[model samples]
Target: MITITEKEFKQLSEYIKINYGIHLKIEKMALVTGRLHNVLIQAGFKNFTDYYNYVVSDKTGEAVTTLMDKITTNHTFFMREANHFYYFKDNVLPYLTSTVKDKDLRIWCAASSTGEEPYTLAMILDEYFGMNKIWWDTKVLATDISEKVLEIAKNAVYSNERIASLPAHWRAKYFNKINNENSVLIDKIRNEVIYRKFNLMEEVFPFRKTFHTIFCRNVMIYFDNETKIRLVNKLYDHMEYGGYLFIGHSESLNRETTRFKYVMPSVYQKI
Candidate 1:
């Protein structure tokens, strides 16, 4: 493997941080090299600097997409964070049903990873609304930075092990067994989620509608404090009044800097 030099590391690190809001600490040098070495060879680049230049100059942005897929971790599974789903179903759903007169429920799974969180949320929404779901616009907008993962999300196929944590009824209702027990998300549930490639570092959000709920779980841990604060404020601006924000259980907002009302650890309300 071609070892990344100090200058090469700085170039790649700055590019990632500036374009993706990810703070790759100096200690992550080994991680960066490990994750990217294969990509460098696959792309036929001799060294890291050459790869960096190609990523920056590639106007189609496919190179950057590949870079993101290689460098970032997208580890997620069904019911990975169970408590947030409980809160959304039990408390948040009730509030939206009562208050949003038009019943157009706008929910954004901001960092949807490989689809577990958004699909899980979709199932919860389907169950919560039941037959009444047809009467409401409950489709979820699920976005991620990597096109690779977005493709997986669109396909909606998972190994049995991946769906093991899902409730039995949800498994039965929303998934169809195929290829010797691998699960494919049923079209009814799969169609409910709109998947897209989104870069959170984009200065302007460009969302036409303010979301009633945003689940940006686990992704922000890669960001530094300032980046997190800026992103949180951007999320605040894009949310409806009284909208809810769910972060990773381990992630928190500085009460002094953010506009979100403290609801619980990893949960906040836009008031």
Candidate 2:
């Protein structure tokens, strides 16, 4: 196994932080080296420095894309955080139904890794709307920094075990068995999510309209205080007034640094 030297680690860490707002500290050296070792060899690089150089020099941005996919953690499963979904369905949906005059609900899953979180949300929306789904536009915009995960999410296929935690009725309705009992998202549910590759570190968000709800769960744990504050402000700017923001239960927004009104642990509302 190839090891990353101190200088090589600094170079790669700085590059990732500058480009993606992910702060890799010395403690994560093993994590970085372990995840990126195979990537380094497969990309024809003998060492970490050479891999870093190649990633920065590649004008097409594919190298960086691949690098992000390798370094970042995309560990998520269906209904991983079930309480958020329950709150959204029971409280947020009712609020939106009455207040959103346009009847267009724009929800953004900012770190929708491998389709589970966004698809779970979509299924909740489907169940909520039921017979009146045609009267409202409820498609979700699911984005992630890693193209690898985006590709997987777009494919909407998973092992049966991956979806075992989902409700039995939801499992029956939104997914179908394929390739010997592997679950694949049914077309109607899959079509409700639009997956895109997005870098959260971009200085300015390009969306023409604000979102009614945003799920940026568990992704900010890698960012530093400054980066997290700046990103939270950006999200605040792009959210509709009174819109909801759901983050990982372990993540929190500093009351002084963000404009979002704290509603509960891991949940906020645009003021």
Worst 10 residues of 2 by lDDT: 37-46
lDDT, model 2? 0.92
Candidate 1: clashing pairs of residues: none
Report lDDT (Cα) of residue 7, candidate 1.
86
Per-residue lDDT over 1-271 for candidate 2, one digit per residue giving the tens place of the 0 to 100 score? 8899999999999999999999999998999988888887777778888888888989999988878888888999988889999999999999999999999999999999899999999999999999999999999999999989999999999999898899899888988899676978999999999988889999889899999999999989999999999999899999999899999998999877679999999999997
Task: Kindly list the per-residue Cα lDDT of model 1 for residues 1-271, writing each as its tens digit.
Answer: 8899988898889989988999998899999999888888888989988888898999998888888998889999888879999999999999989999999999999999889999999999999998998899999999999999999999999998889899898888899999776989999989999998899999999899999999999989999988898999899999999899999988898988689999999999999
TM-score of each: 0.97, 0.97
In lDDT terms, how accurate is model 1? 0.92
- CA shift of 172, model 2, Å: 1.2
- What's the C-alpha lDDT at position 145 in model 1? 93
